[model samples]
Target: MQNLTQAIKHLIIINVIMFVAPMLLNMDLTNLFALHFPKNQHFGIWQYVTHMFMHGGFYHILFNMYALWAFGSPLEHMWGRNKFLFFYFSAGIGAGVIYTLVNYYQFNGIYDQLINLGVSAADIQNVLDTGSYNESIITLPNETMREFYSLYHTPAVGASGAIYGILVAFAMQFPNAKLALIFFPVPIAAKYFIPIMIAADLFFGVTKYSVGNIAHFAHIGGAVIGFLIAWYWRKNQFTFR
Candidate 1:
């Protein structure tokens, strides 16, 4: 294993603490620290950053931190500590922003449709608050209701977004680097592997192909920001020093 770069080391430490502390203390920190819909009662401004350090489960944190150590360390070594930290947080926050905006678009569409169908704002608020609706009082299509319900109640947690950013930056800097995934088991150039991952996320996000709360759009958002930053720095001949 490679020795951790300074910023990456601190990040991994924070993430591990965030993951383990709640379990040891017997407190539920996910609801408070995890990113929630801006309109949700539990939503907090600080969660934009905090959510990046929070993970939902053992495998979630393990995968994210592994990616951080494996991919992020080289970038940190290249960009220097401060620049790397800036890039990490910027991509993470940008991901959250994009995710929220996408959710808003979907939520607004559903809200407008419900209102056109004569559903009251109060009824909508009640449904969002209680996670249930009186079907007799607000008769909408079951799928539509479910979508709205899921959007309002689901909280996004994990470092996947920032890790996606790191992955993109790594690919940009070392396009010819060989990467092999456990599932694919074939070594591919960084350029090829990264794009394939992003494309898969795009497909899954559009189709909702899987039933889990994977934030595919957030991953895309991070990749987009990471690419933009890396491209700009390259174009400007920016140096780590």
Candidate 2:
């Protein structure tokens, strides 16, 4: 592995601190830092950037920080600290925005269905706030209703989105680099591996087949933004340092 560049080192440090400090201080920063649904009372504008530093669990931070060190270090070395930081934050924020938009589409779809079923706007809002509804009144499938409830109540945390951006950038820079995953132990070139990863995210995102509380759309958003920026920079022969 390459030595950690200045930006990657500091980012990992900050993420570790954000993850550890709350536990040490006996504080819950999720309401303040994690990205919440726009209509959620806990939602804040600053969460788009802060959520990149907040993590949900030990393995989450471990994988993200490791990816930052492994993939982001090389990009930082190539692009210099300032450029790398810009790309990282841009992709992170873009991921948050895209994630929110997708959620809005899903949320509104269910909301409209309820309204068309003669449910009032206030009652719908009440369902979101209280997580209780007149099951007799809400005839939508239980799974769809549960998804709507989850989308409104759950907040997104972790650096996975930004790490995905770094992964895309790294692949573009080192297309022939061999990469492998734990489950799929066979090594494959970055050019082939990264797209497959993004495709998996997209498939799971659209099909709702993902296990756990994974934000698959956020991964896709990061990959899209990363590819656009990296492609533009390469095409225009742009260099920051």
The per-model lDDT (C-alpha) reads 0.89, 0.92
Per-residue lDDT tens digits for candidate 2, residues 3-111, read 9788888898899899999999999999999999999999999999999999989999999998889898889988999999999998999899999999999999999
RMSD each, Å = 1.3, 0.8
Q: What's each prediction's TM-score?
A: 0.96, 0.98
- Residues 53-151, candidate 1, lDDT per residue (tens digit)? 888889999999999999998888888998898899999998998999999899999999878878889978988777787787677788888889888
| Model 1 TM-score, all chains together | 0.96
TM-score of 2: 0.98
After superposition on all CA atoms, how large is the RMSD of candidate 2? 0.8
